[model samples]
Target: MEESTADLIRAQLRRLRSAAGLNQEEFGKLVHYSASMVSAVETGTRPYDRPLLARADEVLASGGLLVSLLRIAEREGQPSWFLPWLDAERLARQLRVFQPTLIPALLQTEGYARAVIRCDDLLSDEEVERRVAARLDRQAILAQPDPPQLIAVVDEAVLHRRDERFRALMVHQVEHLIACAERPNVSIHVIPLSVGLHIGLSGPFSLARGADGGWVAIMENQLTASPTDGEADLATLSARWETVRNEALSRQQSVELLKEVVKSWP
Candidate 1:
């Protein structure tokens, strides 16, 4: 049978325990783990957290090997759906984004990012830090020698929401957007409230022109997201992009609107 990851780790643990010349109870005492906990980990019933793995590494004299193995398991731990979208974003020649409720992740400042990312209850603080670091890492591409053009259109009402929890955060985010808009390759636009219902009211999405000349679209639904490169989906998204862009104020006006919102923050 193919060795499952858990099975492989179980074997490693069992071998390491034997090599250390320690019985289950003795080894558990050394690592400050319960005897049953040790048995379960050896049998692959429980997952290893970093602290336990580190302790095992120290006690087994594995020279950080155990911790290194754990790192491999935790690396690239972004949500599965977001990975493909990130791949496309990294190499896109240009990206056009429509945001209905929050700042685009690429342009968000650290404080703003914290406010936005903290909405999730499923994440521990360490996991939240990992995600935030991952997000900031993605922004590095924007500073490369030949960065992609980023065009963003935000709903005017998104900035106007009186969200007390994120009130100050919104002010900082708006200022960041204005500064980013000044970049030679970036364009910012605002979809006026006067436009009344439109295609953008449906949701937010991004259209990317890849460096290889292919096109892709990324759509963000509540908690999940998806990316599509199929011709038909691209066509539909392209048409939607056009409709939304038409409803947005000119780029110059958008910057002014962004600056205008700063006065409303209390």
Candidate 2:
């Protein structure tokens, strides 16, 4: 089998770190990441993103070599269909998201994301890991110096669903949600079960507003996610977003609800 781009990059990272006589802890400090993150990238359990690569390149004096490999790995790792949405997400100034069944991807913890992706069963282990890494990488935007405002409204059911098998995962996921909600740029709202039914029940979707004031919407289904800049689609999704958001608890209340849900988990 051919060595994947990710595998090659991992090898290069490991080789360079060894040559520098630095352990994972030392290298992680130089790059402003945790030692575990360095290990994960070196072990190929987590995918490397542009930010990590750029940091490593500068710190290791690799002359952009590490950053150069990120493009190739991203092209190979990410599905072509999702590229447009990724671009939009990076460029957007504000994002409005609605998820009826599960926690939105942007706010999901690694364990929860893995559990969610593993549900397909048909995906090979390699593919599942690749996807989980990609999803986590996308989340870096939120940690940027000037992250876009993210308003996420989820159905209360998303928090209430429980299973003995995923009990720990759910607890961690909810805890992560509370942490995210505390960020000034990130707001999480939940539509209580008391609301019964709402327009958002149709599916999960997101609207991204760019600096130029134009809006793009992405709708997700089982097979793929579709991005649209059509006026009609934007108008419809915008209205649905407003409706669901109005039905959701305020940010403070949502945080309280999330805390309550976390306690109820086990």
Candidate 3:
């Protein structure tokens, strides 16, 4: 959670404790918290420390429910707003990412990501660096010994043209894609321009296999992101994705396409 949101949760905890008619010292004792620690949480000086949050959940008769919800916010390096989604994604067994306009973030090389970041009109160099760090941190998941299976579908256009420096970076990205595709856990698909209109016209979305083997669909538009965990909605998105997959070029064809584009680079 963002520091501010964490503060707010702490405030709520204080209120909840008060509502149960427990003084700071008494509540701290019940939750294994020091009186000063409780005071710190109440005043927003500290976030919901894990142990305290768990014990407090029980003391407040919440049956440990809030503990699970709050732990998602505790994951380090997650953006305050994106924490919940990150929590959901982190638990996924497989990831299906479709990028209609650009390269998939997880598969991007640092050079490619930096090149993409340079196109942002709003970010200062420092801000871009911060975002880059966060993105790279996310990419670290791909390096795990038993990382989730990743199926990335991208438009062939991303392989062909871009600014000159980005062209070099794109070459590296293509090479990386080829390497990753060779791995048992990764699959790369290319949607050709010849395929024409399809469900992807609605734009990019990520399909994740949840902890319970359910599907979670996540879409980010111009300014907002939405995640639909409903099975019905996910089923519809899965159908759409299947169409796009069928329309896309085969893996061998995509590799050949990348080779052709790399040969044409200036």
Provide TM-scores for the models.
0.70, 0.72, 0.71
lDDT of 3 at 143: 78
For residues 1-266, what per-residue lDDT tens digits would candidate 3 score against the true structure? Answer: 44454555666677778889999999988877788767755664333445567788889886665565565555544443355455445556788888888888888888878878878888899878877776777776677877888888888877776677566677788888888888888889998888777788788888877544656677878766777766787888898789888878888888787777777777
Q: In candidate 2, what residue range of length 10 has the lowest lDDT sum? A: 1-10
Distance from true location, Cα of 98 in model 1, Å = 1.1
The alpha-carbon root-mean-square deviation between model 3 and the true structure, to one decimal in Å, is 9.4
In model 3, how many backbone clashes occur?
0
Give the residue spans of candidate 2 off by over 4 A: 1-75
Best by TM-score: 2
For every model shown, the clashing-pair count is: 0, 0, 0
> Alpha carbon lDDT of residue 208, candidate 2?
87
Count clashing pairs, candidate 1: 0
Residue 30 C-alpha lDDT in model 2:
93
What lDDT does each candidate get?
0.77, 0.83, 0.73
- Cα TM-score of candidate 3: 0.71
Which residue runs does candidate 1 get wrong by more than 4 Å?
Answer: 1-74
Across 129-247, the per-residue lDDT of candidate 1 in tens digits comes to 87787778778878889999998888888878677877787788889889988889899888889988888888989987765466778888987887876688889889988998889
**Candidate 3 CA-lDDT value:** 0.73
